[model samples]
Target: MAGLVWKDIIYIKKMWKTMLFAVLFFILFSFSRNDAVSSMALIAIMVGSNFSMIPFNYDNYSKWNEYQYAFPISRKTAVCSRYLFGVIVFGCCALIYALIMMFQLFIINEIPEKEDLLLQIGVVCFVPVMQSILFPLIYHCGVEQARLYFVAIFALIAMLVIGCSSVIVNMFCEENTIMIIAAMIIIPILLYIFSLRLSINIEQKKMA
Candidate 1:
């Protein structure tokens, strides 16, 4: 599993510079527009959630899926490694985004709004939640087919988050914000676990 995870890390190493450049460019753009928080949150979501998708394309192009069975690895290990890789990517993206946002806030000598903070917290978990739905589809179908579903679903989710973030935050009181954030984190984790199991099953059954 670690080897598989390391393989993905190595595969994506070249992407780090490009992703970082895109992130810094957007951060400056958002700050200039005076909509840094929301824009950064969206950027984090867009980048973090889709980090593994390109690697999937690479895998397909290299016929890694077909060649994987040539190794002695189990299907469960392979699926689990993908999920683990996703967690590492999402966690790092979220952390880096938060740190950069804090630095930006410090530069402006401004504090983040409570609603914005809560919304940002929710959005942080949103990547894994979406991935939980996406991974099983990729395992059952192929990455190409999964990408089609992912685009539609991702668009809908991004719209909903943007449209309703403020309203939902304002609708709830401070105390309820804790519960909301808790749900945001917990639900995704549960969904991720379930998705991991489902992907393992799909892989196990695929060439059995």
Candidate 2:
């Protein structure tokens, strides 16, 4: 497992330019001193899940699944590792971003309160769960279509929820921050579980 992961890192190291640029851009959000930075990291992870598409494509191109066929690892592990690696990649980015945020807050005086750690945590953990929601759909449907579906559906749902919530506030005028936050946390967990089950089923079919 370690070697497989290391090999991926070694491969990624050769492509540091693109990754560094992404890290730099995302870290720029850290200076804002808004909780939304954390949310943005998770959003970055969601977009970054597409990173798996390239490697998956490479595996198909090079016929590397045959090599996995020769190995003794379970098909479950095979599927799970790709997801694991994707998370790891995003986590690394989040860490660097958090550090940048910290520097911006402390050294640059942009944010006096040091909350980058909390923000990083908020972004990092739920990403795997988000991947659980996203990966299977992309895996089975293909990337281009899945990207279209995810962005469109998610944006529509977000707009509808925001619009309706605003209307409710106008009509009844009750603000429940706790309920809102709880719903945000709960929704991701549920989505993750759903994505995991879907991913496993699709992977099993592929192995079949």
Question: Which number leads on lDDT?
Answer: 1
Q: Per model, how many backbone clashes are there?
A: 0, 1
Q: Can you tell me which runs of candidate 2 are displaced by over 4 Å?
A: 29-47, 112-126, 150-194
Residue lDDT tens for model 2, 1-208:
6655665666677667877776666656544545455346545654465454556655665667668768777666666666667667656655765676678678877753324333344455545555665678777886667767867765664455345643533433344545544654677667766766677788789766
In Å, residue 77's CA in model 2 sits off its true spot by 1.2
lDDT of 1 by residue, 60-128 (tens): 899998889789998888888899999997888787768766775887677777776776676678778
CA displacement after TM-score superposition, residue 158 of candidate 2 (Å): 7.6
Model 2 error, position 177 (Å): 8.0
Give candidate 2's TM-score.
0.65
Give the whole-model CA lDDT for all candidates, comma-separated: 0.79, 0.60
